[model samples]
Target: MTEKDFVPKKYSEIIEQGTVSWQAPSNIALVKYWGKKEHQIPANPSVSFTLKNCRTITKLDFSKKDGQEDFEFEVFFEGNKKEDFKPKIRTFFERIVQYSPFLKDYQFEIHSENTFPHSSGIASSASGMSALALCVMSLEKKLNPEMSEDFFRKKASFLARLGSGSACRSIEGDLVVWGKHKEIKDSSDLFGVNYADEVHDNFKNFQDTILLVDKGRKEVSSSVGHNLMHGHSFAEARFAQANDNLAKLKPIFAEGDLTKFIEIVESEALTLHSMMMSSRPYFMLMKPNTLEIIIKIWGFRKQTGLPVSFTLDAGANVHVLYPEKDKVKIFEFIKNELVAYCENGHYICDSVGSGAKQLSEEN
Candidate 1:
């Protein structure tokens, strides 16, 4: 559906006060999107594996405020007031106030917490913003009881994208694609679409073990990295390559070609960093331990002839991807050889998950 279709009509019911809570999961892009356009649109299509354990639980309490001209909200993280987070939330509200018109009419208390460390290479913004968007949509559902389930999900995803581009992928299950690609049916730059193609049994329960190489704030934010792509020498070529790889992944996924999957997934991960390093005033997000971990993974995979591989987000952390069958051996391998590379030996074990969940609703 087009963006215009998400615009809500006048509320049929007046709801004075209520609370909505939602849980949204983080996602790892198999085909990474490194650049973006205006309004959080991806420059290249990306597909992600929705994660189960790394998630954010958000609770929003709303009450009608008398004669409030601007949106009113307080942000909290893990029960602690986070004044620093309000600007971002305000920007998000400004971006989405058009579609969720009721936002300004209510004063909201947003309390959120995450299962994983924030800004540690995992997509915390993705899960966080998506949970918030879903909570807001739940409020909308109360006002418009007749809203279709499909439209609700799509609009929630659309709203999530405005907050964090990858967040659109967090609203759905095992597989999701964002950014329009010719080969992907119904794909849109406006929001993520569930990957409906034939997915083989090999990927049904795929695993991702995230090794935290560094838990520090990113030196260069993702927005800066994405903006650098505007005049990047290799920007066009990289964008084309991402689309080509996505198309290639479709057939590989359907056929259960683990070998081809590894090739593409790992390549996509490295290529993402390559773009970062290649941008003018180049920067390197990968730490020494990050490279060491990648090397160890390669050695272990080749030594055991296991279908094990690695992928990275924009930071120093590494996400080890493998099929369920190899999980036992891979997990053992990680603990023995790779855990040494993680900061303070901290890491998280997660797998493919089925979208967001609504925890509670109260009026």
Candidate 2:
């Protein structure tokens, strides 16, 4: 795409200066967003913390080019060609242009790098899409300094959601909530808000241990899993259970009661999986080792009387949640029992933290 077509007068003024960069970190859901309603918006509103260590850095450069009306772009994952990423790239650029249509013509030179394994299943899409959205917004701001931060984050999140369902949660820091509102076609229904604003004051000390049991990709994506849930015999019951769990956990989480939090999260996760099993054709993500780990955690809870809970995404890895005070005992138990099952399995202990941010421009 030619710069004349893609670069608006505002962006063109900035392009004459140089390139701009931005970075954002990945986030893990505490109350997971499993199903989507409209445009992959969550069925129930969910909350998550943007992780500190795992992140992605995105760089955008603009230059005059010959023969192109719309922007042309390329995406790479860890230096390997990622042809399939075109749709996500195209969607993201389209959203950006929708907000600032004048820049629809310029060709985009985009490069992104992840700090963690691409296929390790640790919410890579969350970080990648969030970073891309942030970089695009940063470029927009450089070109036109009139945009507000609220408008930037909300619009960026709107675009990010088009890329991946989980990406909207990564737009905010510390704690974020996606799908609190109903879905509407005019784009007024979907939005993300900070969890602290929605939840009670006493819920800040929550902690989670990501048990990297296995990094293998998931057999069923969230979209497929949700579709399966729709026709399953227990679909209604499962939805009711999710609603009940959400109701019960709000007060418990607000009170910062580790015991109640563990009970609710564990139950919800198991219920989510149970619905998966009840689906026609009977699919299950848990391995034999997965069951063993669950048993071990149950036994550890029985033995120590500590409040520790485990939850799984569509993948096999277990995310262990416990209070910070119990970290020592939890670490010892995991090292003794779970470490051997993994191929160089590693664990990351993190408490809730802020979402993605620009780390440095030098990178």
Candidate 3:
């Protein structure tokens, strides 16, 4: 891609100074993307809900530099200078330069902090990378001032995918599906698109209460976990199962069939864990408390008839999902039993939301 393809000529007089910020939501996939190919492309199509409150907010200040380097940036996490985060961010910038050509021409000072806990089974990468992507695209729009809305979001999603596979989903609203699937319209392996079309009213306000079984970081990073999938014994079948599930789920989501939705979502969660267990390295990521929480949730659902279900990411934490109407009873159940299993009795309340948004320049 060329700079002319993105930046317009009329706004060629580059601005000397400006700050852009974006807050992008974390996403919890109902159908997880475990294994990936080169360039962070998903092996199978995965669907996720854009979370509301749990997110990462990033602010970027750019200054035009005479030397055209791949990247020159400073990163701060929370209020402190995060030297460890700089390496990853640098690598991300190098990879994204092709998509955001103007990125190579600026000196960036990026300050980012997450609303939810990082490295604790939450999709912090999704929110974090998507926020940075939004900032970079917003900066480009500042230069061009003529980029269309469709070009803005799509390219941001594409650039975010280069940093993190699941991050593409965080750029879009409600629900998004990534990976090329024949059954879904407008799906692509490079980016994510809205797959929640014709979504039932019942699912409009779905809730996700994250039970932190362990607040500590995972023993294995998701990168290493994904690498292990390269030699997984069941990798082929797992991908097939995911595709089949995606096909089965389209009508279920559109028809508002909660029971079938629960079945597929829970199975996908278990299958993700199962793949981990069956990997060539054969390491366990789920805790005993994870099993306890699942069993109790099952028993509670059987007894109370509340339509709540659970899904897990790459770590031991549990993301409890249910309709908004059952919030009272579900929170009650969480207080009485599930909290005991959680790490430090901590949990986060979030739900499906309308993707991410840009921030005003001032306080």
Q: Highest TM-score among the candidates is held by which one? A: 1
Write down the lDDT of every candidate, Cα atoms only. Answer: 0.93, 0.67, 0.87
Q: Which residue pairs in candidate 3 have backbone atoms (N, alpha carbon, C) closer than 3 angstroms, thus clashing?
A: none
TM-score of 2: 0.84
Candidate 2 or 1, higher lDDT: 1
Candidate 1 lDDT over residue span 1-363, tens digit each? 777898986878899999999999999999999989899989999999999999999999999998859998999999899999999999999999999989989999999999987755665999999999999999999999999999899999999999999999999998999999999999999989999999999998899999999988888999999999998999999999999999999999899999899999999999999999999989999999999998998888788889999999888899999999888888999999999999999999999999999999999
**Per-residue lDDT of candidate 2, residues 1-363 (tens digit):** 111232344443434324556677777666666656655666666656666667788776655455647777666666666788888688666655755553454456667787766666576777788778777767677667776788677766766776676787777777676755322112222545665434444445456667666777777776688777556787666656655665566567566676777777777777777877888767888777777788888998998898777877666777776666777887788778877765477766666667767644421
| Per-prediction TM-score | 0.98, 0.84, 0.95
Put down candidate 3 lDDT per residue, 24-107, tens digits, no spaces: 999999998999998888888999999999999999988888878568889988888888998888888888776667777888
Residue pairs in clash, model 2: 5-105, 6-103, 6-105, 6-106, 173-355, 174-353, 174-354, 174-355
- Model 1 has an lDDT value of 0.93
Give the lDDT ranking, best first: 1, 3, 2
Instruction: List the lowest-lDDT window of 10 residues for candidate 3.
Output: 1-10
Question: Considering lDDT, which of the candidate structures 1 and 3 is the better prediction for this target?
Answer: 1
